[model samples]
Target: MTGDTMRGAARAVLVGPWSARTWQACAHLLAGFPLGLLTCFTVVLLGGVTTGLLVTFAPALVTLAALLWCVRGYTALQRDRFATLLGVVIDPPAHCREEPGRVRRLLAEAAEPGTWRQFCYHLLAGPLGVVGFVVTTVLWTVSTMCALVSCYAWALPADSAFGRHLHTPSMVIELTVGGLLVFHLAPFVTVGLAAADTWLARTLLGPTDIDRLRSQLVSVTQSRNAVLAAADAERSRIERDLHDGTQQRLTALAINLGIARQTLPDLSGPAREVIEQAHEETKQVIAELRGFVRGLHPAVLSDRGLDAALSGVVARSPVRVRLSVDVSERPSPTVESVAYFVVSEALTNISKHAEVGAAEVTVARNGATLRLVIADAGRGGADEGGGTGLRGLTHRVASVGGSFRCDSPVGGGTTIEVELPCES
Candidate 1:
């Protein structure tokens, strides 16, 4: 009511025992003992009953499953409590898979390591909870009582111990000092116990180190795949722009030039020669643009599929290319793009460096893997470190978690084999 008292109260609320965290710590300690006791009793009774009934296999299985699930439910409750009170979030392990049959589902739940971890949590919580509760309750109660005892001692019955012991001011002051020490110490004690509880809960209820690492790895893999998909999509867009926009314009320009050279035969000799030179350059530019667009990403690869696309690639190759594609199901677009590039680059290398007149290309799918084998019976001194595109192919294959192997002996024929995942 007084200004000083109000100011003291405000200070305490701001940074003392009256703060929310202190109260939460107190609440956590207060509840831990009962929860621990109940957990211990439940585990003991359930384990005992389940063990005794093990002779009956069916009954034992059901009981064991029930026990694991019961512990799991308790663990969930503890997780909720920690999150609500101290803002600590724990990630539970994701190890259980539901089965069609009830029995199988129960088996999966029981067999999971997380189930046993929850059970162990209950085991440890028992003793820790009881001790925490006892310490917290005794310190808070006794300290407050002693610190305020002087105000109440006179009201006690005359023959009572407090009334008979003189209850002097000196004794009152001494007890008040000692009690105040404990009163202040109580919050620290509660905080320490709460910290211990948090550690136990997080360790038992949350994911293991391996699980966290696996989660991070999965997240990174997903992000990397997303980037690859985006890049592939962008390449397709660029290819489309070239094929639809720039390539179309260039084609029209070349045609117009060709028409002018053919139709304008009455032009002067110098003008006719200029028209002829421009027509030839226009044709050459269109051809180069076509090659550039195809190198970026081919429309056939997206419109049809890898099979149709590879066939077109082999058909265009100057060196005799024997192409065999056996893809039953279409792979993902990103994967198809990578495959197209791999085949196209390999063929280009063969024509440029292999000094071969013939090359063999075979593509097949085995389960979820796409296999490609390109071989040439020419001089076979292919080096990935060499200026050939083998190094680039290796990196591209690895980007999609695929493997690229090149086997080329100096005198033997060159063989390039690649295996890519069919993410579809």
Candidate 2:
């Protein structure tokens, strides 16, 4: 390649984007300095006066609130700037929920970590901004003046100190060298200052890793709750459809067979026998349909609450069951459903796998939590991974923010305990 083309390519590669970025960084820091100074002054004045008045007057809390609010606004601006200029993504801290009473709410807001972080940011901004502004401004000013030194060389008189000692060619060469040094170094210096500002912004203006994780956890929890609600609604719909549509049809078929059996003559012999057999079969089918419908979502559970619903489950258990349910208030349908299923599954497992003659089922509601415990006096080595039923129960309980624990040692009686939150 030619010399000029090679030099142009080098300049583009080394100085093009970096130089633009450096200028942008310098502008950002210089703009932030005045804003930071204003914030520092305002915060200090308000803080000092508020601290002095807090001993006697309750109204001084308002001043503190206003100061914190302003600090948050300033921090938000910094975060936005960082994202825009430096391409650093930062999330604002989660907002605190307001308490019932005004004073309590104010205290809660003031105690938030984000509020203090912002306060610290505002306090440090003035000094940090000053440093960045000075460094960047000096570098750019010196670099530009050196780069344009040839343009102003004529203004220096030959009798002056610089002109008298240095010949024209020597002066030009020295000026050119100095210009190249400053011009090349300016972008790096600007970038260094900008990096410092970015570090401060990220540390003070953005939420910490723990805060981000907590936010993600909350979002996941909300999504889980939504999914559980949808599932419950679908279950209810299916139960309704079975009860009103298929179950009703089966009941009507049974009734019709009963009527035909009654109407048929005894003298019909073989035909009479066939009608009787069909009648019996239809009745059995109807009974089976009722069981399936109840299994999907029991009508008693919805009508009479968890106590009566569990009673039905215990009654149906093949093994002897000692049932004790003490619940004064009816919990939400979702919680009740989870509790019922947990007990039902535990009992079924005990009947099939535990080889136990007797089991104990206890369900009680303590404040906002519904606790269900099922124990079987049988050889117990139950594992959740051993069966789909237990794993399914675990998922169901977790969906509603409930906990399911199984303690079944080898040769020891099995115990399944569940705690379900009743909050809607």
Candidate 3:
């Protein structure tokens, strides 16, 4: 007990400067209180009046201005302060805007969920700021008086706004003692305030970071599921194509060849040779079916990986292709397959519609991302709805949480880039 007591006393004596810092920081935090108060009050009152006036004129103009100032402009300031004082990353408000046109844009802005959220934040800021002001100011004043009392023999006088006098000796002693007592408890109160600030900032400003990330993950998962569905749908389509066209032709050819084979014994050598020729034609039709099915889904993509699968695509491409791959690590089967299909489809588009001489394809893995860049020196002007192939490719990429961009200008070449996360 004696040793512990001595250690604590030494620590307390050493805590003098640190205690000063703590009080100083608290004071600085309090000093900024008035600014927050003014900002909150001004924004709320102005926002309310603007919203009311919006009903008379264009409601979106004034409300949008208020939102921009309150959230987009001031959010950074508030978030930075929260991080410094409370050590938290608060989400900022989502600022949504529409293309310029008076009535259309105004209606669009007013209809958005984010605008309403900004208005709510504006309304709440005033009351929240007032409470924060009182707590911070009171705690800071008390801590300062207690620290001043450590050296000064007399207590300081309290000046009132209403011309009240409060400088008696007994009053000084009581207030000084009270200040010292409250100062000791200031840290706990400050910690509570910081936590409240973090919570409220996150709730009012925008969605939490974790929440945003989770929502993104959900979207990715949904899109990937869509891709899988689309793949199955595509396989069924290819199967139907074969069944309806090549399969029927081959069946008729088989019946003819069988009948010729049975009559070969009674026929002349020339007749036998003709049946043999027809059999050869039937074999060609079967070969074409195999090739077409392979084009739809190559087994090599599963066996040899994306590099070899893409090589096959290049060989079949009508346009000259320059392929470069620097994938050091193998991605998950699904991801690699999706990426290969994306590149293949893009190259196919270039061959069919780009009207270009040559195309370049580069696939690489930089960290956990799989990057595919395909650029063609062909006629540009590629748009999302330009064709069914590009449209399907967009949905496929989106399904895997990947982004697809095609920059094809008139009289210029087309360039397509896709980035997919390789998490597995």
* True-vs-predicted CA distance for residue 365, candidate 3, Å: 38
Candidate with more favorable, higher lDDT: 2 or 3: 2
lDDT against the true structure, per candidate, is: 0.86, 0.81, 0.70
In candidate 3, stretches whose alpha carbon ends up further than 4 angstroms from where it belongs are 1-32, 59-69, 94-106, 147-150, 154-178, 208-214, 217-424
The lDDT ranking, best first, is 1, 2, 3
lDDT of 2 by residue, 63-105 (tens): 8887877887887787777777767667776677779997788
Distance (Å) between predicted and true CA of 116, model 3?
A: 3.2
Clashing pairs in 2: none
Tens digits of per-residue lDDT for model 3, 1-424? 7999999866654463357444544543563476466656767777667767866675547666555556555667767666665456666554445568765665666676665655566556556666666786777676676546645543434664655444655655665777765766665565566556556667767764665786688778777667675775577467667867777879788778977778669888888888888888787878788667656666676678788989988998888999998889888666776788788889878878888779999999999999999998787888887672878877777766788887888878888889987763
**Clashing residue pairs found in predicted model 1:** none
Residue 231, candidate 3: alpha-carbon lDDT: 77
Give the distance in Å from residue 22's predicted Cα in candidate 2 to where it truly belongs: 2.8
TM-score between model 1 and native = 0.82
Error of 1 at 190 (Å): 1.6
Name the lDDT value of residue 122 in candidate 3: 51
Best by TM-score: 2
In candidate 3, the residue pairs with backbone N, CA or C atoms under 3 Å apart (3 or more residues apart, or in different chains) clash, namely 223-399, 224-399
